[model samples]
Target: MASREFLKILSSARLGDVLAQQKLAEAYLTGAYKTPIQPANALIWLEKSYFSVTNQELKDKQTSSNSTTEILTQIARIPLAQTFQSPAFGFGWTSFWQLAHTKAETQLHLAAKWQLANLLINPDHQEIQAQLMEFLKGKNISSSLEAIAGLDLKGLQKIAKQFLQELAETDSPFTSAAKELLIKLQPKNAALSSLWISWLDDKNEEALLQAAELGLTMARLTLGLRLAQLDGGDTKSNASLKKAAYWLELAAKDGDRDAWYALGEIYRRPQFSGYSAAESDRCFDRAADLGHAEAQLRKGANLWRKREKSDEKVRGLQASYWVWQAHQQGIAEAKELLGKILESCPDPQKNDWHELALQAEQAINHHVEHQLDEDWLLLCHRIVIANQFHFSKAELLLCEVGQLQHEHCVVVDIRWELPKILPRLIQIETIQQRRALLAAGKVFASSDLEIEGNLRQRRYRFDRVTHWLTTTFAKANKHQTNTELA
Candidate 1:
């Protein structure tokens, strides 16, 4: 909700007040009054203020308008892999280019040109790929980009390439990014490079920086690691860590798990100016999600250590799930830790989880072997929910999925089954896990009254479905073994 004060400012802005317009734009740009940061909306009022001041209206407000416009321009100057989700994306390039071009009477032109050129050539992101069709049709073409092209595709790319080359020749924050994009755009250079990635580890600063600028992940990663090293705990040595973070963040954004892990370590260094345990955990989690075996084991171990939290047993189960993922990736430490954890925790039957998943898919249908396949489908949903959220069997069977959702966790209350049992809170973890829960919740949402009757009837249904699934799995398991042997 827009605050009453902000609403007054908005009303005044709509009534042709230039100061109100500028204030409203600033508020939108900076998310003032709990407003969502909407760059497109900011640009609208800003453009109004810009031309208004240019027309000799409110001359005193000129400098502040210019400063705000430049800030918006910088925000528009994002990376080559940006997902274009806003009209502000179009306006950013346009506004940023004009601002930078005008400011380019000095050194700031390089930043503006870097953004315009890269955005023209290098946005091969999957999200942008869909819009290539629109680009082909010339539908949604911005005039600034069209003007920069100087000709068709060939001249457009050539102009962009020239801008990148010019930017790289100068030293600035965008220099490395410009060079990396140029290297990526030119396959010939990538093909001609004969230097082994291993050689980067022992390379000098100049050699490493040059190669890293040329989009070699190994060189950039090595350079970042070298810079991130402690310099005898000198608090004044923050410059090195900042530079390291810049290079590492680029690699991490490009989906390098190793870079993500390294970044996590860098964030955790006590001597670093920006040391943050929470940021370190987020980086490690990203690495873990990207299938880093060591990260998975560490994440699992960390979760297990915190098992004495709210739902201790459920926490242990959740921790085991991460360890299980690590085990599949062939981590020896994960296997050892998993063995020890399983020794203390009660797990389900030793059937392959993948195999059980397949069986669930097979059994959740009209069955030739039994008339209880319908209930078995609901049973599969229950099993998936229990395994995902680490709910108890009774909670899985009795808790209403719709009713149990809290902000960050699921409230599993089976006091309906056993009056003495208290409600337990289980935190939602991954998006995949959340999706699985939502899917199961949807099934139970549409269920008939018979499917979710009294507690005694529900338990009886659960028992029948379990028997059916067990019997079916046994037959299929034996048949598969016999076929493999024969």
Candidate 2:
């Protein structure tokens, strides 16, 4: 049931109106104006509209070129009129006419071609397949595959297999999708499958290597992993490492995330691949970009570690972005790391503090429900420290502070009278304990030095404690300093 307006547009379209035909085609494609969903009708209208635009452009090109150029110059110099004079003088009329007389023909051609390919799904139609092949000759393979997938056609497995094989031979971003399709098409008793099975069952390394060389993606990754982890036969020898790297690099080129991550690990270990930090980071970045969660976490952690050593603000923000991405993807370890990073962040803006508090609350709730004892404890310490720095206002911070007070009350008392207690309190690994001891030391530093008879003994012990605490604070501050953005 087409609306009256749509009927009028279709009437105008049949009378050879290019705009009306294009509108009618859009209406059919979108089922607008109560039109039934008929892709065939859409394709027909699109083709008619495209040919009409092409005829008009050819007619315009046949006119005097000097006259057309002069008209374009005059149109470009004229500003918009204050009031409309005629429908022909409407806004954008000149530009629209120019575009339709020039570029619109090509655009319409491509649109019609895509719509036709999308509508034609009969694999038996040699004409349609030929048209598709012609259109896809120099186009992006991934986009072509996506258009084909939308057709949802049956009985085209052979054609699809051929396309996948061609894509697999190319070094395109769609290589992974092509490899996956190839694996799906592989027979259960294929030679590559048998070789992979043999290697899995009996550690037949040569069989796996042969299958890998035969373009089996999984076999390449498996053989690479096996070679990387090989023991007792010069495992870290240069030749062995180079061979492992070769296989891993091959798999990585075919868009295997695990292979990229494994290469990153190999390059990180100096004993394995001579320790190229830049190459390791690059591999980790590639894997992370390919949607590997572990790679994201590892990259984030390494960036944070490096930022500590270099005190670079850019690195800190980069670390936070990666860690936050991993956390959003539900990586548990990422949550704890992000919480600590946010807590130690100094002088963050209001919005940053708000986000930090929210993340802390979420981490606390998750760790409590899952009974992740170690993670919960670490987050608790981080929350308390964050509250000390005013980075967050989580209620769990108060609870942690109370627990620290109860556990270290005696140590706090001794720290005031005896400076030797500083080292013992600092030896405790908990962040809360160390922070409390440091606070108490500040209090002692501000007090009077009035002593009775044994001033020399007291001063000597205080000097030793002062020296140790100074060295420890210097080292900690060096590593834990806040990143200052310019």
Candidate 3:
């Protein structure tokens, strides 16, 4: 199926035409001229072409010691001089000594050395193992041995060990690569494990990456954390974040609690990997289930905040349940929130409610006596206002304040008639101040607030809100005073 032109070129190349040989090599290498892609055949033809050109050049030069010495010096400067030195050139060196009495340094000699080395390293050759050993012992051909270490051939463990021993004997440019190859070829062992850990402790990134790629869970998790902590907003930083996520996810799949938590944190930040609220929640929930205490508290808080916009009563219940779980595990913030939820339960007359209320009272007293700060006192008042209103917007405001702990001022406009002494609309900063203005209980204590709009935008009656606030604040004040006396 060969074209006439291709056959003509092949015929010319086989007849020792150097240009035709080079062209034929290119054709085979690239599968041009309707030739089959054959890398080995291409290297063979290229070597032939190179040698043919070198022979003609030598024939044109004067057979003088000075000329031969100049050519040898130039050959020594070839970038691959270290790679192309071979024991096969021993015959050529003897011939050179008898003639010009100088070391062999022709391009033909160099090309043959490199081509043979490349062919031996190409794993497809059946006798590569033997050839590799011979080449390693040959003159200045250690670079070829290094290339053999990089090949993914089976039964190279012994060869790799030899490389390690030789590399350890002296410093060389190939030492680091040799070490990596030896590690890859050898089975994982305690000594190697210790070595890798030491490398990691020394902040050797290449070693860490190699260990991670070898499926070390801890290494993967650590690398992920290191990548995630890289500070920047540039393209490289984003790429690092993605890579961090990949490793963290891998570790998490292997049940790494910290990886799960870190993944959750990363997913929550939109700039890092594009935010996915659901994915963030899922990761946090998984971490919490794995007994990550911070994750537990964060999951609970996220659920609690989401309840305001969610119409499902189960969502609020789950929020309380998680907060209680976190509290039982000794998270201070969760304990505070659990107490607030129990004490502010809408139906306090139920037996279950009464029991929870007692627990809440004890928890709140403990918090106030031991962990109370001025900021906490202000936060507690805000919580009371948010609970009394039972409006989504108010709950959102409380969530924001809890998260940020910044000063917030808001005005409530109530469309209802009130006593001249009572203000229909109020601008307030703290729940305690609102309680003071509604202490009379003439309006808010009697009826439920009429609210409208979606859950996030619902409004409430002025009297009903004030009544709830007055009752809640009074109970809180009494409980605190009693606890102090006790």
In lDDT terms, which candidate is top?
A: 1
Better model by lDDT, 2 or 3?
Answer: 2
Better of 1 and 3 by TM-score: 1
Candidate 1 per-residue lDDT, tens place, 261-362, comes to 888988887767899999999999999999988888889898888877736534466676678688889998887777655432123333223344445546
Candidate 1, position 77, lDDT = 38
Model 3: CA > 4 A from native: 1-188, 230-236, 308-315, 344-486
User: How does each model score on lDDT?
Assistant: 0.67, 0.53, 0.52
| Per-residue error (Å), model 3, residue 229 | 0.5
Worst 10 residues of 1 by lDDT: 343-352
TM-score of each: 0.60, 0.34, 0.32
Model 2 weakest 10-residue run by lDDT = 406-415
lDDT measured at residue 250 in model 2 versus the true structure, 0 to 100:
81
Show pairs that collide, candidate 1. none
* Model 2 stretches with alpha carbons more than 4 Å out: 1-152, 162-180, 187-193, 210-218, 226-243, 250-258, 265-277, 286-301, 308-486
lDDT by residue (tens digit), candidate 2, 6-41:
999999999988668767756765678988755445
Model 1, runs deviating above 4 Å: 56-97, 103-111, 125-157, 169-180, 186-192, 197-213, 219-253, 262-283, 309-314, 339-446, 449-451, 456-486
Ranking by TM-score: 1, 2, 3
Give the better candidate number (1 or 3) by lDDT: 1
